[model samples]
Target: MSKMIFINLPVTDLDASTRFYKALGASRNPQFSNENAACMMLCDTIGVMILTHGYYRTFTSRTIADARATSQMLLALTVEARADVDRLVGAGVTAGGRADPNPPQDHGFMWSRSVEDPDGHVWEIFWMDPAAAAGDTTGVDA
Candidate 1:
């Protein structure tokens, strides 16, 4: 297994991406950050690299997705409670993100809401209830 979880995101401007992610409660890891790209730490080990399109292309042979006009990443963040899921999704929307075209889904064991970041990256905030899951026999993944 790897020690790091790297999510390479294509951004038109690195600084803007850094600021946008900061608004969503992420801190820039200075040890792995510069003007062209920066590691936005999501957790102790997970990070999303906000790399400039040109700089990121070196890692792949294909063209970068124009995230401003289309989708590229679909990230799911699971919380401990349903209210937390909704609150986090709402916070993202308040910070210039967009909510998905669906309502909060209650899957007996879990509830979820999806949002899109300012750069069109999809994020699903979910909450699982173990007690509800134990009671329901057919609870499926949300």
Candidate 2:
């Protein structure tokens, strides 16, 4: 079986968060979702579990940081092309997310932009040339 990643997040409103993810193209997995939590599948291998603060607390003893005020981690998703990166970020913004919480990055071979969900979780959308990523600069513009 292929390994999968499930990023668990604390959300104040499960329905809103679920809607936000759906707008960003993630589908809900009903089998693993309930009233207190929703499992949003970003892809076959990546999932985001949005849980209410009370339910999230049951999993760990650590405090749940308010993402709006604190920088926990930057989640990144790669796309096939630069246009795709922009499209995803734009879709996020149209879905009630904030655009470019972090400055946009354009390094010739790679491009990236960020968007913040309503709860302030940052998602970096990026694209990198396959040749450049493989360290092959021949014929590929830097």
Candidate 3:
């Protein structure tokens, strides 16, 4: 069987978190969802489990850190095109999310932007040209 990855996050507001994820093109998987937690499908192989703070604490003994106050990790998703990166971030912003404090990155070959959800969880959307990234100096100046 292929290995699947699930990124679990603690959320203060379950309903709002659900909406935020849905806006990012993820759908709630009813089979793994309940009142306290929602299983969001980002794609076939990846999922996100958004659990209430109370429930999330059960999984860890350490205190749950506020994502807004500290950076634990950054979740990134590679997209098909630069426009797709923009579209996702745009939807996130419209859904009451904030754009990354840092400016968007444009590395000629790769373009990336980040958006923070209402819970302050950061999601990076990026796209890269294979040829450019592979050192195929086609149109690069340097």
lDDT of each: 0.75, 0.91, 0.90
Ranking by lDDT: 2, 3, 1
Models ranked on TM-score: 2, 3, 1
- Summarize candidate 2's per-residue lDDT along 79-119 as a digit string, tens digits: 88789988888888888889999999988889999999879
- For model 1, residues 1-142, the per-residue Cα lDDT tens digits are 5597878887776766676667556889999998788999877778989887778888899977655566555677777777887777777777667887346687757788887766677777888887665765454444
For model 1, the superposed segments whose C-alpha errors exceed 4 Å read 67-73, 101-103, 132-142
- Model 2 C-alpha RMSD to native: 1.2
TM-score of 3: 0.93
Q: Using Cα atoms with residue i matched to residue i, what is each candidate's TM-score against the true structure?
A: 0.78, 0.94, 0.93
- Model 1 TM-score? 0.78
Clash tally, candidates in order = 0, 0, 0
Q: What is the lDDT of residue 99 in candidate 3?
A: 83
What count of clashes does model 1 give? 0
Better of 2 and 3 by lDDT: 2
| Cα distance off (Å), candidate 2, residue 16 | 1.5
Q: For each candidate, C-alpha RMSD in Å?
A: 3.4, 1.2, 1.3
Error of 3 at 77 (Å): 0.8
